[model samples]
Target chain A: MSTTTRMTGRRIVAIAAVALFILHQDFWFWESTALVFGFLPIGLAYHALYSILAAGLWAAAVKFAWPDHIERFAEAGEPEGGESSGGSVRS
Target chain B: MTPMVIVLCYLALLLGLGIASNRFFRGTSRDFFVASQSIGSFMLLMAVFGTTMTAFALVGSTGKAYVRGIGVYGLMASASGLIHAAVFFLIGIRLWSFGKRYGYVSQIQFFRDRFGSSRFGYFLFPILVGLVIPYLLIGVLGAGKVISPISEGRVPPWLAGLVVCAVVLVYIFAGGSRGATWANTFQTLVFMVMGVVAFSLIASKLGGLQAATQQTDPAYLSRAVQNVEIQTREGTLIREVGVPPLMFLTYFFVPLSVGMFPHLFQHWLTAKSARSFKLMVIAHPICIMIVWVPCVLIGVWATGVKEIPPLAEAEAGKVLAMMVNLLVHDEFVTGLLTAGILAAIMSSLDSQFLCLGTIFTNDIVLHVAGRERFSDRQIVWIARGFIIAIVAVTYVISLVAPKNIFDLAVWCFSGFASLFPLVFAALYWKRATVWGAYASVASAMLVWFYFFHLSEYGHEYALWGGVMPVTFCFLAGAGAMVLVSLLTRPPSPAAIEKFFPQQLEIDQ
Candidate 1:
């Protein structure tokens, strides 16, 4: 993919992840009459699945939108031992 | 052996572990507070997860699930898994960077420097301490609930509270942050294992998951609110099925409090590197699942079990302990499960106690009296003194037997959630001003007080017509922050540059 396309894709993924998180909070699915595997409450099961998806989305967020400065901080060795403030800023 | 003896032995083992951790203490205030920032990933994960679990997640959550049904898991647990990890990734990493670069040991230090006013610490110190005291009460109250019941009426609630407070104080005073981290890690493992064990034993004793769940009221299995009719001494009355949909939806904001927790902020600074956070982000949700799934299920099972009498609303907090005692039957297992629940409660208590002490000593005293006047040894002593005083105050308050553990926790978490806007803006928005910070704090607290008073007066207290109190409080804080900051002066270029150095070129 081109640089612009990749950036656009990343933005779409980030936005989608955020939207999913917000929508997951709403109880539209609470109206569902279905039960999970005939035992667990459907609402309870939905959230359990929702939680796993949330974890995956956050993983994507780390992969794509992980702040460059944080990566630099990681590469720079022990954060506590370092004193160079300017090292956190990239040109 | 009796359950009481086993519990006493468990307490003794904790004290032993606390003293053992002291051998690694380096005798510096830095080592005392942040453990010299040498904590690795697994320890960091365990410590952070343990501190967040608290009695709120174990005792309070199980009780809440009993009252509210399966919907209880969705209200906080499931959402928390994601929201907490997001907070860790977004807020925690940035704060860790700032803390490392600027040598900040507490949240108040960051706010003081960011707002360009040392006086801001004065305004913040008491508010943060007041908020934390309620959070501390959750643990103390929970410890009392777990211990008092298992030991029967022989041990009063106040005695249980005293034992928990004294045990935590000994470890924290001796080993400081390092000791708390080690204890929290050990406690986290103990509680997670015991939680699953208790769930399995109880479920089997109640004739397996399918049969147990089948025994519960059908309305209890659904999110759709229904009028559950029950026959009581006062005659038949109706109870609501589960949490209202809107209230359940708005609970997503409560976990956002993790961003502004002074205790968690201190934990963030203990990371050896930003890389240390990677494990926390990935594993936090998974770990939350491990702990909460069993608690919620067991709580749901309690509704169906016929062995114990139906729990009155007021007696909901004892559901978990009652389940273990009635179902397990063995003194050893019951004592072990009680210890595990207490482990979860004490893990958070030690951290909160240590954080309050660190804040009082570093933010209030050292900042006001001047650090040069106090010796390093004196500083540690000052922190220890404040912790002891706070523990005494919390223990005394727990004796009064105030609000339900879960209800009190929601109010406490709400206060922290309302303040989330202040910290987020301070870090991410250059236009964020000291005036805006002031306005945000004032607005959030005022709204919180109004709702709190309404709750006391028996009002449902939803804001903006059925929206949760946290929604309005967060908006009031964020809205005041943005509008007041724009109308007022932006932070100085120098102040902005400190936080956002790369933006200096763009601004120029």
Candidate 2:
């Protein structure tokens, strides 16, 4: 992932998340008595698909929005002058 | 008899898993409370997701869907899918980083350190435990209600509640949260698979999913509440009712409560690496869909099923169990479905029992008595004793628990959602102060109680003009935190440097 693409992906995912939230209300389907696949209500089906999109968006968040700096802090061991590692025995 | 045996076996398996996991226990408070921080991505997802779900996901959602229609899914599941992940990504990772960095065991520790006030822990501890007791009752009471009907009354609700509590305590006592996570992982998988199987068999029995749904009134299937005018003896009136749009929109805040759940914070700390959060962040929404869509659908379908009895307002929680019993008559499958329901309930119970114990031992007992006074072994014992006491108290209350599981859960969740603002600001806003946090909590509690006192819990309760109390409680909390934080002197720079370092983009 190039830096520009990574940044763009993050922006796109954020926009998509906001769109998903807005679409979630589904007021149009609120009164419609339609069924999809003859088994699921149109409203219910819309939300199920919305849930999948959300999962995808969160995956995008992990890929793009993950804070490597914070991870580096942990991997780099305790910072100098940090409090004495509290009272814990890490395996 | 067969179904009852299966439920017993299910409980036994959980107990066995916990006892077996205890063999790996390191005999230290760290290991007992947080699995020595060794959990990886898959187990982290299971534990976090499992704890987030409770009787609320299965029995309560099903029950609520029965009364409220398919909108129940919209009101909670879909919004929860988005909001919960947002919180996990935005808050969970940051908290995990802080917990690992500071070796913090409980949420109170993080808040206490962030605000530089030990008094905050004392304030926050009782509220967290107070709210969690109702959460625990949701499971215990849900279990009692769930098991009796599914087993044809061979096992009464009180006995079922006892067995469920006993089993959870046994596993929690032996395994601590580490054991609880392992058991949660197993139980989570069990419930998910069982949820699908039950949904399939019951739908197959009731003609088909679409056919079962279409059999009900269109009004039941519709999520819209529209205006209808009527004439009375004295006057004419217009009414707009069903599911209020404002109520639906405000429900979006209820799931935000997860960001502040103490048990979830404990699970977050268990992550072995920051990367472990990646899988959890991705899979949680999909997992929620898999569990909720069917349960809600089954609940709606129960309305059309001819064999099922009419569930009164108070008897709503029993609707799911009644469907399983009346429709899936094969004893063996009923047993499995019952185990699945119990799985969802108990997975959450073990974690809650373990978490409350963690809070009492680490936050209250040790902080006040001084860690210097007790050995690590003694601390673990103190935790165990306190956990057993809480479990007994929660179970006794479950005996006379209210009729509607969903309503009870909503009230409990509203209380936690009130604290969501305080935790959010503490993590993200460096300016948040100790006194600001105090005001935020005070206002949040006052507003939450103001609304709660107004509610009879007799009908589905909402605030002015059909909005949920959570929306107001959350606002009051956030408004107070930001206003007071600005007015008060800012946090010590040292606190800022500790929580935020080098302008990390995530923090920014």
Candidate 3:
């Protein structure tokens, strides 16, 4: 396979790993913790999670969403007739 | 003079600047809305710093650390800053690059242009502006409340909020980003001085950090995994703490969506250079440290106080207010500090209000009205009017919302989180289509609101704590976006060529 396909495969695998981690947390951290340790530590852990996640989510949004806008936004600099409004249009 | 007088003098200074900056405003819509794209690194730093660190940092976060002990010092105060620094590294540089390339004015403009779909603009702008306005209003209401009591009821809360709103609107309207930058520079100095005075005095009184820690329990200083779960208001449950490895992964992936927020992107679009952005990335970590550490310490310090301020039990945000009131006995310092806090509040409020105004006027209004090339005079008034209206609405929402500051803050940014997937794809994935963006945002919001907000209020699940709502939203939304975009045909090469010429060039 080409280098492009290799990178895509790597990204997909990385995404899968993340998906597994989050799913595991939902089970182990949220469910298993309460069963073993009393609720206080679990509550504290959840509160920490809430705060971190809020900020984390926003940062994630930025990383994922910004490049597309940058590329799309770059269209305005293009010479006319190459593209409509100097943006990508699928034929 | 008393702190109150110092405060009044500060307010007078800000008002004078507002009036004075108008001459330099150039009366153009773009200038009024975005400071004519001439915002430098210093101005941008002040604007971002002054706005992001607000009454929340001053009172709320510290108060939390005080009550919760030192756990907050480690997690909320320190970690948040560290994470924000990380965010700047991952996303800030890219955002600045786009902002320069597009001459983009608002977050919505970036979104609309990126998706190459005007429809996405219509969907995204309202939700973003809506979320931001209430958050801004809440800041105003809280500041007003803090100021009124600090003045010994000499100033009314509603009046204070109104006065703040009016002053902010005038300056923001008059000079736009320039006004925000100049005002923020003045404001940041005031806040830092007040912070130093207040923290120093409190530390001395409490026999310094070691004694204060002992008094408040040394456990606060320990970064152990103990007591992570506790009984909340609703019932016994696990407390959400720790940067779970899962969340750390999300952090790596999630900043991928930074392009989605209109206000955040405005910062991007207004950068002087990619180098300036890079500098901001390097410097911002230290800046976050300077700002958050003292505030958290103050909070932890407040916990040791024998006599607490009233109403702190009901709300955490008011803890800082009570701390300020409890600690400061002298009138002069109080007035100066009050002015500083006002500066902090206005710093955030003015920037947010301007952001909201630009989003509405530029993206929502102009797009819907189907107009182009509006007169400079018309644009300025419209932008100002939108700001005033948004502030008013937010003020009312803050009064009536009945949510805790922490809860509200997290919720306000929920859309950004939920929409992260769609945004990431648009940026990095060449095949990401417009429908994918819309679908991802919708799916994430639906799941988030259902599980986190509505489910809790509706009392749907007391025992079912196995699933993390955020994780669920991330997977569901992100999965949907990729799948949907893949299923759909890609955009025309011609359209892609016009809009994404750089990507094409880079590819070449």
Candidate 4:
């Protein structure tokens, strides 16, 4: 089994996302009048699938490219002090 | 009559929930603004997603689809899904950490601290508020457009806008961000579920899904070109093409606006943990799919429905309401769906209202006026007062405003998208200086207004050949930032060290 480095994994996801953006144009489907499931227009069907794919890509990005360093930085900071709750919530 | 009754009840219920949520208010300026950073994954998903999905999704997209065809989804939802999440991952998370580390409540605060310029707020604040006013108006206007038809015009559009603004104001006034999150979570569910139900009900009324789509003109189903002359900044050319490839391609930049939305910035800060963003990011595209597919389909389907007839130029925004009222015969269901659509609109409204108030209180009143002058309680009151004023102003403006929800949203989104460069550079580019940031914003607005003026603010305006004004505005901002930053001194190393945690880690 091969292990993926963080940078390589991020690059792969980034490239894939860019690829998806290009694919989003869907020129092939744009002029096609065909319907998916006999109800969905080809352009609409293509975009629906594309949106789901984009969601999947984001999930992958989150898993692989999560900025762990920022979390560490925020955590290392001293806790916030003196939260005041006396103010009114109304005008 | 029954539908009207139900919608009234639903509004009353929402107001009731706002009062209930206020009981749990932590009663602090921070809690009022960002819910004291206590929102979890699901609620964070709901609030952020709900805020992003405004009248633009339901009313605006439907109207756009009615005119432009199903390509509206391709231009908007699919693109937003990819770009918005990327923004959240890169910009949102990093800023959230900065916010938590420094007790930064507003985006302006982060910008001021990052660029080491207090005067930056004077320029950025007005731009933000101006852009956000259109966004806020979108919700109020959408609710008015939809509600009147649902009630058979028994309730006037003015009254509808007034009721929505007032309800959102009351809730936000009491519950603040926490109430907004709770309301948004509830409304998000209402709209998503009801959206599917409305989709099915409408399609069934037209025979079936296939039959309903068949009712649409084929030209309205495809993204093929149409011959239409458009006014551009250069001058009007007798060119004959609509939704050209360049225009379609450039539409991608428009969704990048979410990266810079003030309301969205405030919502990002409300997350309880960094991990909470995962659900919102991953699920956002799919959630967009759920809402947009139906609304766009319904809009296109309205073309063939005899019940809907034809709409005048100004009547486009009312298409969604017309369809729901005419097709779905169940009075109870219509009322429920009206609440659902209002749910979609109001969710964004409350957040925008609260965000602007937070900005006014934090950026101008506290930072500019000097914090020592006002008591903490007074500061809270000022936030509440500002929110009321905004809601009031928005409601008044909505009355005479243009009814083209789609065009209004595009222009608003374009302004924010144009500013995305400054935000991106501020976060990642250590060389980004205060002067460069100012140039970026100024260049963006100048270019944006230039195109807008040439178009006469027309709905169908385009640039050089077919690209939207946003494409040029975004480029100008990016170009100016790069050019001006190179010409100017780089940000101080101490400022870079403050914003760039990796550097701080290395130093330690």
Candidate 5:
């Protein structure tokens, strides 16, 4: 893969690992089968992964719901120096 | 010197540092406010963490844990910390990347740039400033209340608070974020050390971590799996507060959205690079866990130890002070720990003061005055003046405000929640019309005022179990964004390309 893609991939992995560490308890879950199924519905899984997944779903919903609008907004040209094109231009 | 003397001396040293840091101020308005965008990731990271762990966490969280049990400790302290980390991951990195690339300077700028709405900036500005004033006042009053008893009432709580605010304003006004960044690092380190020492002392007194934790009531430890009934003072069963574990998965998004808070956005904006931003985000969950769990556990332990008075009888923000007094009778250590708590309070208050002042100067004042560029010297002075003014206003409010910290905090969040959805839509949805944004903010605030704030109707949304109003506010904003944008002529292609270049491929 290209350098930019590789960087992006690394970022995703790093983010995922950090998310897991934050939400999930390695010590709590590694030994306890009861925890895995018990917390799944509440998405607690007592793990950071649950928290990360919830957030990811919310963000994805937002992105998917407004793909067209997002594209249009992105296509909006850059504001000229000292001029705001999005609204009334200030002198 | 005695503990009080030590604390006073620490306060003086902080003031001196604030004054010293002022030398770095480059006489620019932006420099005085945001340090002219010179802050790097480390400073930004420290500032983010330091500014967020407010008086509430220091005192109220402990008090809550003391009263409610370990479940309160986990929910208020650990959950908040973990959720905060979640926010950083989902939104913080993107906000930082966008702000740096777009030259976004203020929360208003972000809302405006993302939504292309001058009106949205104008609308949200007042609401932000309004919410921020009470929020800052809580910090001041909270610190003051804690310090007063510690000083044997020698330094009145209000005066102690005023002094802390004055010292913060001095450094913040002079050095801007530059001063806040370095000062916050020291402040955070002090808090971390004091926290660990205090936690260890408390844990040991309770017969070590495992023993103490095991002693906690089963219900307190079971919030993850159990649903408990909440009761009113009259013994009436209030509606259940906790959703099922499955429902909590969805409800978890509420606090996590705090990453979208304006102050958090500013931290993201100041990071040196996207990598630095990511590192900070990744590190946050660990940092939060280390600090929060011990405090919550301490709170849970306090509940079993003795009979603390009910909430009304006790000073609202003195729970930590009581715990410290009970645990550590050593005068010097007490003073140092008191100073550490003060550091946490001041660090949070200072960053907020800077943020509020900057928003007023950059978003409201500049917009209202219809002038953007002035000499850097004038801007710096004006910005400082705004800081002083904001502090004074908040002081008066805190002095006279009738409600307790929790009530006030909820109110503050209500104000921001009204506006948060609009900004969220603007970023993610291209069709988010300015009119829709305005309507959502206006209607939500209006509903909040009438139902939650104003005339006491028996049927209030916040008090009652109606999720509909909040859900409606969120949906109304999103709906307005879609319906209005679709109905109106699409933004000019040049404007679209300028405002949102990533969307250019849609032309095909």
Candidate 6:
């Protein structure tokens, strides 16, 4: 992917992940009486699914939103004086 | 073996571990405070995970789930899983880079440098310490609550609190952050394994998952409370068992506290490289699930267990231990499970204690009194002195000012969460000014104090009836940052260039 396209894709993913987090806080499952497999409450089960989805979203974030400067810094290895190169892009 | 003996043996093992780590200590202030920035990814993951999962996750959550029902999981656990990892990815990585660049060992140092105001540490140092003391109390109180019941009156609660405080102090004092990290990694494994074991055993003993759910009130299964009559000492009392929706929604802000914790800042600095944070970010939510789901399930099960009596608010913290004793006939299993609970509690206490000491030694003593005067050995000793003093103060407070572990933790996290806007803005917003940072701190503290005072009268009290105090404090802090910075001049271009170079380049 082109640099700009990848950056835009990351921005879109970041916004979507944040929106998903906000929507997760709403009380949609609060009144649901359904139970998952007849044991877990619908609310409890909803959060369990949410936790899985969150894990996936965070993995995506690591792949995309991760700052390229950090990747370059890691590749360059620790600087001689232990100072981070100030010229790198900000995260 | 007796539970007290088991606990004593565990403490002995911890002391041995602390003493052993001392041999590996490099005898430098850097090694003591930031572990020489030598920690690998796996150890970093364990240290971060262990520190975050405190007594609040195990004992308090179980007790809370018993009273509030399954909604307890949603209140903090599920949201925390995602929010903590997100914070780690966004805030932690950036801070690690800065700390690596600037050699910052504490949050105070970071703020002082970022805002170009040494005196800013004066305002921040007190608020961070004041907030951490209550957080320290949560661990001490939780240790007492777990040990007191399992020991069945043989060990006094004060003695339990003292033992935990002393054990944690020895390791942290002897070996510093390296010792704390080693201990936390070990304890993390112990508690995670035993948490699942205890959960599985209790569920099966109660006659399987389906049978357990059949016994619970249907209303308790959902977010809405089931009004149930409990047999108290005087008479039957009606109690609400479940969580309120709005209060639950607002708890989303509480987990954001991880972003602003000074101890976590110190931990982030200890990372060998930025990549070390990847293991922490990816596995943090999974680790939260591993530890929390069992505790929440056990807590919800406690509500329906016919053998266990309905618990009053004060006694509810003991629900985890009560379930262990009531269901498991094996004394050995009970002791091991209790050790697991204590493991979780002590893991956090050691880090908080050490972080506060680091702050005092580096930010206050070295920075204010001048670093040239004190030798590196003297600096380490100064930090050890502060750790001992803080532990003693917290132990005494735990005995006198007893509160529920979960409630105290929430209030503590709210204080940190309220300050999140300051850190977030300082890192991300190039226009954030020193005055704005001050306003954010002042506004957050003022709003937090008002709600904290109100909570003392009524535990259920919320700002404007529904919103949690954290929501208001976070907004007020963030709003003050934007408004004050816009009204005032932006930070100096040089300062912005130093921190946000890429943004400055774009602006030009």
> In order, what lDDT does every prediction score?
0.80, 0.82, 0.59, 0.82, 0.58, 0.82
lDDT by residue for model 1 (A47-81), tens = 78777777777777666555656545434444332
TM-score of each: 0.92, 0.93, 0.77, 0.92, 0.79, 0.93
lDDT of 6 by residue, B1-508 (tens): 4777787888899999999999999988888998988899999999999999887778777877777778888788888988899889888888877776666778887888788887788889999998888888888987887788777777888999999999999999999999999899988988999999998888899888877777776666778756778887778988876676677778889999999999998888889887788878878878888888788878877878877887786677778877888898878888888889899999999999999999888787777667667777888889999999989988988888846545767788888999999999998898888899999999999998888888982255665435788999999999999999888887778877667765222212
> What local lDDT score does residue B174 receive in model 5, on the 0 to 100 scale?
61
Write the candidate numbers in order of decreasing DockQ. Answer: 2, 4, 6, 1, 5, 3
Better of 1 and 4 by lDDT: 4
Worst 10 residues of 3 chain B by lDDT: B458-467
On residues A1-91, what C-alpha lDDT tens digit does candidate 2 reach at each position?
5656667777888898988889988888888768889978887888889889889889888887676666776555542222212332211
Locate the minimum summed-lDDT window of 10 residues in model 5 chain B. Answer: B238-247
**Positional deviation of B100 in candidate 3, in angstroms?**
3.3
lDDT of 5 by residue, B1-508 (tens): 3778888898777777777877876665545555655676677667788877776556665655554443343343445545675456545655544454555557777767655657678778777776677778778887777678777888887788788887887778667877877688778777777877888876676667666655544343334333344333445432222222332232333353364466666656556554454445545555555555566656655544553333321342455566667766677878887887888888778878878777776676665666445554665666678888988888877777654554466455545555556656655555666666676677667765654544242222332332323444445555655676677766556545544465322222
**Candidate 1 residues B26-140, lDDT tens each?**
8878778888777889999999999998876777678778777778888888889888998998899888887877767889888888888777778888899988987898788
3 against 5, candidate with superior lDDT: 3
- Model number with the top DockQ: 2
Chain A TM-score for model 6, please? 0.69
Off by over 4 Å in 6: A71-91, B403-406, B457-460, B503-508
Off by over 4 Å in 5: A1-88, B73-83, B86-90, B224-253, B256-260, B307-317, B370-373, B454-473, B503-508
All predictions: root-mean-square deviation over Cα? 3.9, 4.1, 7.6, 4.7, 6.5, 3.5
* Real interface contacts reproduced by model 6, as a fraction: 0.32
Off by over 4 Å in 4: A1-4, A78-91, B227-242, B400-406, B503-508
lDDT of 4 by residue, A1-91 (tens): 1234666667889899879988987787767878899999988999999988988898888887766767777667643433322111111
Over B58-86, each residue of candidate 4 has an lDDT whose tens digit, in order, gives 77788778777788888888888888888
